[model samples]
Target: MTTHTPTTPEQLLEKLTALGIEATTINHPAVYTVEESKAHRGDLPGAHTKNLFLRNKKGKMWLLVCLEDRKIDIKLLGKALEAGKLSFGSAARLMEFLGIEPGSVSPFSAINDREGQVKVVLDTQMMTQSPINAHPLTNTMTTAITPTDLVRFLESIDHAPEELDMNNLAELATKAE
Candidate 1:
């Protein structure tokens, strides 16, 4: 029998330890995008997330987490949040604030927010997931956590997220059609 070794996200282990949350990380080579991450998934069962790091015209930063299949309309989001026009934050902004690269973005990086300059917005539907999956700082690994533990971890980082309805996606889809 070929034994499979378990890999963990080093940064994530440190963060979860600090928050007193237990988690398991599936290790793989770094992936730059969600599409690339699929190659590393081996039998892990849970709802995976698609994390977007964005900023409003006002320079306010946001970490938006949603289901992998969810679609977002930046225009409608701007109108809903009353944030004028929103755009994907620059690579410099993302690295400086979240300490992550483009395809490796994940809510887990919010732990590096020593200045607390970013706001996290989670899709309400994601809250229903018992075991939510995300990249641990890098796309090299995926971490699974209980929703309760995740909330506590977010609170520990002082990053209280605003949960928005997934219906917003449907509205955008309808308008597009």
Candidate 2:
């Protein structure tokens, strides 16, 4: 069997092109923290995002997307979203399931979610933006695309999310820093 390179931001853009979703990307230094992402935002226009890769107590994986600075409570989140106890997914699972690494989580990696095993969860507010910014498949780069394009891509990959007002991540953000 011929092995192919795993999904990258550029590759995702190409895939989007075929799907008729016009998108663009910006390459930046590897950003492991959300605060670092803010530095790049001034030059990049659109809705910026924060990505969370989580797992339930039973090991079910989920991808949560929201605006930067929102706080999230895992316990309250579990209760509100009915996810049954959630925590960050392990590095091994990140690679195996989403084909990404720690500190590089993004909804775009949903492309690697070939089996449709991981569930996508988005904050209700993010849907209001026309174009949004997110890591393509790595934290080192960011991509900007319309919400319509994002929804289309997610649908194509079969990971269209369930929107929830369950977690207030702005608090989490303040505490983290």
Candidate 3:
């Protein structure tokens, strides 16, 4: 079997440029978690993202890009999306599907999903915020782009994303508690 090469941050940036999407990138020490990233953002004005690669029992997969501060409940989200028994996709599966590792999960990684196997979801609240910040396929740098440009880039990769109100979903979950 032939091995596949993963898209590097520079290549992703190049794709964005080819799509005429203006984005700014900032480099920092590699961060493995959202909390760890907080110390590096400085005063970047925009909504930072927390991404999740999830799969249901049937092999259906989702790539969720939401506001960094949004709290997600897997069970409730499963029910909401009709994606029963959702679980985090394994590191191997992440690489297989999106050509990314656990910590580097990114909606931008959709470029690697040439088969369009993963459904991409962008947070409504997060999308409303300008200059959406996300890893450009790695955790050592953040690429910032206007929400419109982000969607344009995703669409350019044939991975048009669904925008959902994740904040409202979180609110509903809280009320149920």
Candidate 4:
């Protein structure tokens, strides 16, 4: 079996351009959480994202992206997705599948999943917002792209997401909140 070479941040940006996606990226200190990212984003417009790499007991993997501040309950989310008790995928599984580390998880990393092993999930509320901000397969920079372009990029990589209706997900957030 041939190993898939991991796509770098520069390659991700090039792919965005090749697809006619107008995106902006800015360098910043590496941020491991939503709160830490806010200080570094510096007025970057659009919806900021918090990405979760999850796995079920059966080995099903999911890349779930939502608003940075949104509350999430893993059990509720697992029930909603019928994923059977989902938990965070380990760093080793993350690297093997998405070619990214824990702090750098993003839908863009799906580009590296040649076998399409991960199920991508996006929050509907975030989908409605433009210029979505996420890491471009790394934590040291933030890339901004329109929602349409974001979906286009995912589709280009054959990783079209299962859009989660946040109106329904709000109940789960309420439980956590």
User: What is the TM-score of each predicted model, taking all chains together?
Assistant: 0.85, 0.87, 0.92, 0.93
Off by over 4 Å in 4: 170-177
RMSD of each: 8.0, 5.2, 2.9, 3.2
Work out candidate 2's RMSD over C-alphas: 5.2
* Residue-wise C-alpha lDDT for candidate 4, range 99-168, written one tens digit per residue: 8888999989999899988999999999999889999999999999998998899999999888987668
Error of 3 at 103 (Å): 1.1
lDDT digits (tens) for residues 1-177 of candidate 1:
222222235756886887789887877888776677666786788888998888887888888899888888887776665566789999878777876778778877787776788998888898898699988877777889987888888888899878878676546445544
Ranking of all predicted structures according to lDDT, beginning with the best and ending with the worst: 4, 3, 2, 1
Models sorted by TM-score, best on top: 4, 3, 2, 1
Summarize candidate 2's per-residue lDDT along 1-177 as a digit string, tens digits.
223356876788889999998777777788888888887656676678888888887877889888777777777666565666789888988888888888778888988888788999887788787578888888877778888778888999888778865345444334444
Which clashing pairs does model 1 show?
Answer: none
Model 3 accuracy (lDDT, Cα): 0.87
What is the C-alpha local distance difference test score of each model? 0.78, 0.79, 0.87, 0.90
- Greater TM-score among 2 and 4 belongs to 4
Could you give me the TM-score of model 3 versus the true structure? 0.92
Off by over 4 Å in 2: 1-5, 166-177
TM-score preference between candidates 2 and 3, better one: 3
